[model samples]
Target: MAVLKKQLEDMRGIRYDIASLKGSISNLKTPTARQFVSPRQMMTNGKTPTKRSTPNPIGVGPSCISRKKPVRGNDPRKSAARTKARRRILQGKQISEDMMAALQMEDLKQLCSMHNVRYRGMPQARVALRKIPGLIVSDTEDLPNRSATGEEVQGANMEDAQSVESESEEEDDDSSEEAEYFEGPEASKDVQPSAH
Candidate 1:
């Protein structure tokens, strides 16, 4: 009789489970609960699915100024002291003696003009320019020097044209001299004592 009662309790539990499942199915069918239901799986147009188009969210689009963007705070000149002139400036050193001594009369004049220093001649200009603080030498000290004024440039151009013409004449005279030096192994052997 106890086994029959236990069997009856199991049968009741099965029925209760079926009733709960039916309730869930009914809830799923309701319009309010079915709000999240996906649209019908039927394809649009010619029954093909299409991916939605989206703008690239990464880098700048077509409006970017240059393809190579300047990364923030990455100046190579600043990072590496590539030049002695740059290193000197960074160290806050005064005018280098070599640069100061190498300074031409024109350079001193230019410096004196910058500081509004009045000087009679090259010596006075050099002295006055040396006295001024924060005088800077150009990084391109090795570059071909140019005068500050237009008049000087005009005179220089005339001189250059004349020199070019003169050099052509000099080249003609030197051609015979150059030929002796270009006699291959014979010329080099002449410089030696003939290896007695």
Candidate 2:
């Protein structure tokens, strides 16, 4: 009796499953026949769905896509020549000694003028002028002889020379006065004076 009851239960479960599957099938809506295409037919037709025409080939269309003609009179040769000339000037060799000396003198005059010093004398001027270049000289080894008297010819203007001389004299006087003040009787004032 128990075996018969179990068999009846199993048949009822199978019937429920079949009814649910049938409901699911009936609820599904099939697509129309025209919506489907066979792969063989599409391949045989060799037709592609049309796409919108591409935007007109950018800017001036296909007409301006050709190579542009060269501009007239736009020669690079003149520019090249100018560049060469500039290079030559920049890399040119040093000036001769005479020219260099003259330039040095001119530079000295300008410096002197700026400093309110009167630029004068051929010999003394040259000596002083030589000193000007030395101011710019990087090497002490290149200094002109300090004891060279020949370079001190009597060419410097009298007034200018006197000024330089008086300036030196004044400096000397100041140093002497300082020395006397430091080393003279005043410096030893703390000590008793010696009897005459």
Best-fitting candidate, scored by lDDT? 1
Model 2 worst lDDT window (10 residues): 93-102
TM-score of 1: 0.22
**Backbone clash numbers for all candidates listed:** 0, 2
After superposing candidate 2 on the true structure, give the runs of residues whose Cα lies further than 4 Å from its correct spot. 35-196
Residue 99's lDDT in candidate 2: 29
* Model 1 CA deviation exceeding 4 Å by range: 1-94, 136-196
Give each prediction's root-mean-square deviation over alpha carbons.
Answer: 30.8, 26.9
Candidate 1 structure quality by residue, lDDT tens digits, 68-159: 87888665553343244334434544444345555556656655665689999877876776676555433433222345553323212555
lDDT of 2 by residue, 1-196 (tens): 9999999999999999999999999999998678555454353456645556767755646644688687885546644544443343244422222322334344445545643455465455535534553233333233233234455322234456668989988887777666666776557656432221
* Candidate 2 steric clashes: 2
> What lDDT does each candidate get?
0.58, 0.51
